[model samples]
Target: MFFFLSSLPELFVTVNRQPRGRICFSFLWVEGGRRGPCNPTAFAMEQLSTANTRFALDLFHTLNEKNPTGNIFISPISISSALAMVFLGTRGTTAAQVSKAFYFNTVEEIHSRFQSLNADINKRGAPYILKLANRLYGEKTYNFLPEFLASTQKMYGAELTSVDFQHASEDARKVINEWVKGQTEGKIPELLVTGVVDNMTKLVLVNAIYFKGNWQEKFMKEATADASFRLNKKDTKTVKMMYQKKKFPYGYIQDLKCRVLELPYQGEELSMVILLPDDIEDESTGLKKMEEQLTLEKLHEWTKRENLALIEVNVHLPRFKLEESYNLNSHLAHLGVEDLFNSKADLSGMSGARDLFISKIVHKSFVEVNEEGTEAAAATAGIATFCMLMPEENFRADHPFIFFIRHNPSTNILFLGRLSSP
Candidate 1:
């Protein structure tokens, strides 16, 4: 049965409502090569390119496990580029040495090499990464590294020193901001408002994820009518509910006591599937069951079967906005990246040792849903950019609905978020 499930057409979706495709931009510099002078910057760039691809795949699995109903966007360019600057600062390492340490004939080679290692890291570090990803992707997330550092220091009760979060260059800040805007579809504001650029802060790393989609059987706008929504335990508010009546790729499993719907993207490379509990009144149980049963691998297996058929569905999703921020220093430190945070650590590749230490890591995200479709964005500048778009649909999220933005070709998730209330 599972084997049959794997035969269904795959789909990929994005936030911009366009055809799904893979696009990447990168810059490299190799300093002080044995033949002559290798561009250290090039070596650092290569490292970022390699590391980010690995990170993206790992992140996809982590997010897929937690919330399989949404889109995901990741900016390897921003994260790798910023990390490259930090890599330059590492001590006892020449461009040639660094290049040799992370050997690769092509960018794809680097990705393949680190892919498995990143997966291991994700498995062990799921909680930390998910918390960080969610907070960083939240709307109103900070833009400066120092602010992020300070916040993180306080959160983790880490001791602060004078050497932390110096400053970044204007050029670096601009580049980071551009990546942020690009990833967020111009929704995030004031990414680098002020005091965000300086020389001491030479690099920034960022990653953004998002997910949204329409119903397999879309609700007609005419059917959409104002409905009262309950918030928390008490607050009741009126909201629009989109109604639809059509056959959908759906399933009702007694084991899980829920109904499932699959929403396909433009290329059929990915789909945003939703699992609603039988007891809609008890949202927690539904959410919990969905979380337990929905794994990335399982979804891939289930969607492969052709048993799914059209069924009637009345969809109601509320418009919602959630903003969160994170300080990644502690998170990275927890991930065994403590050396980079210490002044004693070598970073001569970027500049002289004792001259650099990570100053900050900031992230922000936003989302909006209307009768037409869904729009969302996320930004990380210290620095990062992750953006995606897919075909338009009649997916009016009037009631609580789950969605996922995914890549059909790679089965990679770029972003994942949920809209429970307007």
Candidate 2:
């Protein structure tokens, strides 16, 4: 199911689904507001985006340390959306821990910023398909607070659904998975498995994001050829390499020793930025080193419109596909969110009593890049600088590199990945 915002004023679409294929739709009149550009200097979304970027980089480094030789793909927005809903119902130390770890200042700030961003992206006339969905599934007998449900719908556009997890956990799993699958256009079919949700589970928060778009400047299919992509300084493998030479918004940083390139999508609202290290080193380690020196201030100084030069670049990027799933419980625990998963978790704000704690955070992502464009989807359940210049401006991504699909207006990263061998 999708949403369309037309010229008609004040419309709220609420879709509630029960166990099995039962779906009920309700529409409410929502008053419209003054439409204007969100000022970057004062808006909470910009500040949140900056803080979230740092957190995303930190998480990327953590994941990189764990899997040195493998590929990495994740959606911070997806995971954060799920956890943000959980954050709405936290208090005291639990809330403080999660707020600091997730880069959220307050529950209201998180909710408002997300609501504004969602409204901006969901506007009509967008040339691509970008869908974001959130759902809260509670056991039939669990008495979730009314304020919690109202806040989720008002701020995050999420709806609560009652499922029979108390008696049939397997069936509840299927119901949630089917909703996730529909949200991601089947790119993420199975997000929850047998043991993830059980009879004891009181609540499960899930978020899914899907994006598909063609390139603003399409690459020629005939130019794509087999080329050797260096896995490391010593190892190499031949892969299908896509070639495109165009004048893109590009920049260089001497301190970090990397080149930045931004390739816009058809709508120009979102784009893919790639960072290629100057040396042919392990991309994971290279990425970690670069990430260490990265600050939001320095990133702004580098990628700022006045800083980048639209130089013609010979780009040779390998065509690749990646689909990966991760259980973020341990990762969040390691990152100082230790209270939420254990007995110390204080989720009293979700329910009147202190009875709710996060059970599992299941995240899965899929991405495909070819000559035409990109198709990527991600689902989450409860979860750089430089200066430089010089010789040839050829960005031959024959080695490992980092890439991000970000919304240009809000500067929110929808997807982040590393192409190690692909």
Candidate 3:
């Protein structure tokens, strides 16, 4: 959820949910086309995906550093897409900051190519339901530039709906929230909190999305049993360990001394990649070493297709769920993106004047992992180990590990998080 409730020209927001058990999130405030250079051979989606993933890792590091020992789950696609929409209606420093914050500047013709990328990501007929939605709202009296409106609508597929925020802020909030709730299939009933919309509100932009995580080779519930998950060298917690053994794309990064496992979803178009480090008995040999080397270049080198090989693996994963919310104003400021949220902002692209600025940005996310997966999992409960010297195939996530959901084709990361204490 990325909420854009500003005390300025307009409000922007969005929500996300997945299938079966859904991911519920809403942004009360509102919300890339581009091929990047540097790698001229790459497609626009590839370049944008690189930028998105780079931002995802940066945001993950920031959040993890803020709360090192807690569970984290956020939709990088949701946040990045939402912010890109908002930045669509901005120019000058406001645009520069947003571009810099997300590394969109590296991409050429970012808005148009981003539209293509977003549209491709949301295409129907996938094995599971995962979609990104966009819409716009404005105060009945406020006048917005046709250029901004047309650009946002064409680029993000957002259709503007006029609401009387000046006279009926409460009613407007309820309407917007209900719309978001309906869009999320009632997953988020209250997207716009009471005080988020008031007399000063002039416009709003909202987005919604749905996602599903169905494993291509799911864990067996029968094989799953309570196991000890080490919080660190000194502390451990009991967790239901999901067990599975099958051939998957696996790799070993000697530099970080970690094993990477790619677990595809039902369609094989999306996957969850896990990074598990060797456990150390003494000292805090946690994810610090792994995190230290997590640069975009290194990540690309580590996860590239050529670097991995299909191999049989004994996978032991903990079934966990996480919900995280963050006010991105401070974090964006730390990234030198403070203009959009403060009075010094310039968003003349939206209203043809300098009356608009993003006041607040709140993001909330939820996700769960269990033994359940695609319908095929029930039929084959493949349950099972590895020896040293040969190719390593035993993957044990008994301690803290890093994982991210990735769109296979474009290499865009959908979600990035870690199980610190789970």
Look at candidate 2 and give me any clashing residue pairs.
253-386, 253-387, 254-386, 254-387
RMSD values, in order shown: 16.5, 8.1, 8.2
Candidate 3 per-residue lDDT, tens place, 177-236, comes to: 777666555555566678766766766677665566578887878999999999888889
Steric collisions counted per model: 89, 4, 21
lDDT of 1 at 81: 28
Predictions ranked by lDDT, top down?
A: 3, 2, 1
The lDDT values for all models are 0.36, 0.66, 0.67
Model with the higher lDDT, candidate 1 or 3: 3
Cα distance off (Å), candidate 2, residue 20: 25
Show where candidate 3 strays beyond 4 Å. 1-42, 280-285, 374-392
